[model samples]
Target: MAPQGVAIIGGGIFVKEEHLPAVLACPQLSLKAIWSRSIKSAQETAKLIPGDASTSVDLYSSDSGEGKSFDDVLKRPDITGLIMALPITEQPAYIEKALAAGKHVLAEKPIAKDVETAKQLIAKAQKIAAETKATLSIAENFRFVQGYSYGAEQVKQLGKVTGFVVRISWSMQTDNKYLNTAWRAKPEYQGGMLLDAGVHFTSALRKLLGPENAVDSVIAQTSLIQSYLPPVDSINAILKTKSNVVGSFIFSVGTTLSAFDFLIACENGSVQAEGSRVVTTRGAGQNATKEEKTFEKSNGVKEEVSAWAESMASGTPNPQQAPEMALADLELLEGMLTSGDKDGARQKLELQHHV
Candidate 1:
């Protein structure tokens, strides 16, 4: 299959530092262009690419090619797909435009603010698949992370996935001096911390447990405005699925330590991942066994790019963390916030699941 030419929109810090390098490392994909919309962003990212690159007005074609806007980037004749890393509020519009342009898309998580918008995006994605056979995927990199990928194997050998737990937390060292004016702190931009960071836990939940599974019930507590930022500081929830699968999750960004993303509780065994280290236990109390699996820290962005490139090239979508998974997670997140135990009343999972 021919290499799919990808264009990355938004030259944000995450995309430039994390994703751009990943796209460059993927042998199957070639970055055709980029659209940052700022001279500073365009120029800053221009230095990261290795070929004969140049800066333009927030939009640039790789290898010293012509410049274009976000719309132009989607409409370009040579491009095959778009890699979106824009703010959550800005995501749907671009995804819609890209789909309308008949291009396959890979976007960041939390498809939209509410369940209905997410459903709209999902419908659009389905229409794209039905009409053009192109599809949309989310960059839930945690599922593709080296540690979690290997941990799943241990869970399989231990037995069936009966239950699970996840604690995903990270510390931000941003200067508060400019935070008030920053778009990140605003709900409109970042979609709150859970949508931004906790999303990893939700997506990983689908991966660690299983996709096509919806939350039958959930109990949650979210602390946001009371924190340093104008948004919620962190969220804690206990989720139960229709399959009677139960799990606890804590997704937080305003914290001290910057690690620990997962724990998978299986029937006969349990597995936990602290960064790259994974420890697995097997059997009952009398004949219990445990082993730790060590994996190297890989270039995550590269792996994601390779996977996306393969999907676009082969016209086949990988099952893990597919479109349905993203939607399920979004529904879970919405239910989480709405299901708060603040009023001492059990909240129902009101969002509908397509799966």
Candidate 2:
């Protein structure tokens, strides 16, 4: 099959560092164009695409007088797909437009600012896709990470999962490039850094626990530890799964401490994951049998892009990071914040489906 021509819609740090490289690396995908708010930023991002200058990637912007506008790019018949890395609030409209143009879409996590908008966008996309036969996928890269995949497999060996715990923390200083973005610094989007970063962990948690266990309810406490980001910066939540499994999650983007840990306890054994290493233990303390495995480190961008391109070519949606799955991640994050605001009151997950 011919490589699917994909245009990237956002020219930010992640686009340059992750998406661009991933697009370049995916044999099924061809780097076609880049669009940003400004032509200069789009040009700068185009420089990062590896290729001869004679065959340079096209650049477009909302304000660019020389290049094609956003609508023009969407109208182009050659571009088969779009990879969006825009803000959470700005994604739904573009996604709708792209789907209407009959282009497959792979958007970044947190489908929309809220569940209602997400549902509307998804329904519209699905309608267009059914009529036009275009595909829609979310770029929840955590689901594609090799280490997380291995850890999830190990979790399955532990028999019926009883409970789990997830801890993710990192300090976002003023100098951080991601935080330096005006929208991220003073996010008009819901959940600020928490929602922006929280979706990844929520996606991971959902994948690790498997589809049988859905986060039925959540009780959470949130605090604004950092003055730079508004609303909330830290979250401590307890999740109850539909199958009666319990889980705890702690997410902080302002704390001085740095950690990433996920442990799953089951009737037969336990699986503990810290970064790329997953350790599985069974039996009592004295007779405990432990096995440790470390996977190659990856941000999973390449895998995700490749999968998206494959799906676009084959006319089958990648089941791993479906739109509804991403919506479930958003639901969990939103539920946590909602519960937190009510003094850790329990918020039920009202979504009808689970991935």
Q: Cα RMSD (Å) per model?
A: 3.9, 1.5
CA error at residue 268 for candidate 2, angstroms: 1.4
Clashing pairs in 2: none
The residue pairs found clashing in candidate 1 are 36-58, 37-58, 224-232, 224-233
In order, candidate lDDTs are 0.69, 0.85
Indicate which candidate wins on TM-score.
2
Q: Candidate 2, residue 134: CA error in Å?
A: 1.9
Put down candidate 2 lDDT per residue, 1-355, tens digits, no spaces.
7877889999999998999888888888877888898888898898875559315588899998754899988987889999999977888888888888888889988889888888998898888988887777999998888777887787777788899999999988889888899888888877799999898888888878887777899999999898987778999999999889888999999899898989889887888877578888986478889998887888788889888888877778888868888888899999999988899999999772566
Give, for candidate 1, the lowest lDDT window spanning 10 residues.
55-64
Work out how many backbone clashes candidate 1 has.
4
lDDT of 1 at 206: 57
Model 1 Cα shift for residue 24 (angstroms): 1.3
What's model 1's TM-score? 0.85
What's the residue-level lDDT of 180 in candidate 1? 41
